[model samples]
Target: MVGPIGNKFAPIGDPGRQAYEDSLQVFEEVIQAACQQVGIEPVRADQIAVAGEITDQVFRHLIEDDVVIADVSGGNPNVMYELGLRHTTGKLTIQIGEFGQLPFDVNTIRTIQFSRSPRGLIDARNQLERALQVGLLEGPDLLAVTRIFREAQEGAADIELSTPDVTVETSDDDAPGLLDTMDDVERRLAAMADNADEIAAAIEIIGAVTESAGSEVQKAAQSGASNSVRLSLVAKYASDIREPVEKLESQSSEFAEHMESINDGVLALLKMIQSSSPEDRPEGWEAFLDQLISMAESSREGMEGLNTFGSAAEGLGSLSRQLRGPGRKINAAVNNMRKAIATIDSWDRAARSIRKPSEV
Candidate 1:
């Protein structure tokens, strides 16, 4: 049961079939098996029986079909057009895409993303089958409605996850594709590490500038320099630290934003884990936990790094307070840490609940 990977043929006057041929072939094999597991016939829209049926026949299926499994590789214009028509219906639509090619329209929607490797093909099939099982249960459509924007003026999409024990809120343009989401987690972790280190270095530069001006400040105070002259001295010192302070604030803001997204992905993942039963874990339970634990640890480290920054920034109390925007970010980072720690604690308890089969 495999159908519509787009009417992708070389002479067909459509360039939508841009997936690596090898991976496409793998998808065909595994998709059929997945369909068979759930007693559904898979059909690819490779052709239209009637001339105008491209609109009439296809439109009927898009609207009337129980579910539509769209492989949106290459963001094929044809597939996208059909997918858009289906979106208006808000029916059961499962979108699958190649890594790094996720589109903005479905950015916030849950998508199955895979690389073009052998294992990746198998993983995509597994995810598809699970999605089918969930959809057939009369659950919400994968593309149920236009995603809600948490910050309307900012136009950012949000994923808010909460359980009795913990709550995590984060915003995304779309999500990091689950498979790609992990890769994104890794990238952001590295970037956060870099940003934190750079901030520490920038702070050192500020400290040096302050110490260098100490003697001059003392001399002016002793000599009873006039108010204007003393103010000029302060201005010169402020100038010396302005560039580094500004840099610190910019990096701090980015750090806060990135940290939120990281926790967002982590919490999104944890919810998925809690939803699945022990008998049917999402992906391989072991591998999933491995990545989850790694991200959690990295986030803790990031939190500590921010704590260190907060302590260091406190030394610049009066000066930084006068520079309002620069100091605002540190507070956000500290607050984000508190939220993330709650998320991690919840995750830790969940992980410990999963015992190995041998141990069980």
Candidate 2:
């Protein structure tokens, strides 16, 4: 299918006009070559009809055709959705993409990757011919497709399995007894609570800094600085401070939710340990065990949220430093903030580990 490459090409904007035209020209040539390679007479028209009706036409053709070749080079959402519909109909579908342009979700799929060069196009045509011989007439080989998918999944599994496990040692003499471990967990929970408070304080500080910087920019503009100079200063201020402020605002609710989940988990773990006994045990050891399980679950969720926040914070800091230019006090300050966030992430992980209960 062709045309309506992407929304970026929907309007005749200066940035994309030439590139869009070039891509369409290339796509038409590729399709013509593909048709000939499969022993089908190439459509006489060099140009494929480009209009709103193309999508409907393609869908109807897909329903009738024994095989469908989809070009997903531009990552067009509409094309991807239509391709998905083709898959649902159980037709033999061959996916093709430009080199280095595949979407993450379908990167593992058995796709024909092609470069934009003449040699690459020839190679892709040959491959498509072979695929058509095997795929179209045979009505799609389920076993081959299954094997391709299984290998991809197994490669991902292998990466997870290869990750090194972390082990912590305790002294045999002053080894952390159950009680000691429990105490440590409590201390870590308290520290996490303190860290959450610190995050809130840092956000407030960032807001204040932004406000002060804005005021300074206004004064600089009014102090007879050139309009160009004032504009540059304002841009720098936005580039340096806006992201951190925005990110802090965006993540506030998420951070609060994570902290609340962690707090609840810690409290439940403490109660479970405190109420344990040989007889007349806690009313619901099984239920209490479930709470411990939830503790791990919630801790993981909270950590993931924090990790996201950390990444945002790091990007904000990096952008801030870049805006401030080199060898400046503001650049140094942003770098320090980045390092502080990194340290917080490390300490947060350690705290969570300490709070995690031993497996029964």
Task: Identify the runs in model 1 with alpha carbons over 4 angstroms from their true place.
Answer: 1-27, 47-52, 142-360
Candidate 2 C-alpha lDDT tens digits along 173-195: 86655455445544554554444
Candidate 1 residues 78-103, lDDT tens each? 67888877776656787777777766
Off by over 4 Å in 2: 2-19, 41-55, 142-360
On a 0 to 100 scale, what is the lDDT of residue 64 in model 2? 63
* lDDT at residue 68 of model 1 (Cα atoms): 80
What's the CA error at residue 27 for candidate 2, in Å?
A: 3.1
Quick one: best lDDT, which candidate? 1
Model 2's alpha-carbon lDDT is 0.50
TM-score to true structure, per model: 0.38, 0.36
Q: Write down the lDDT of every candidate, Cα atoms only.
A: 0.60, 0.50
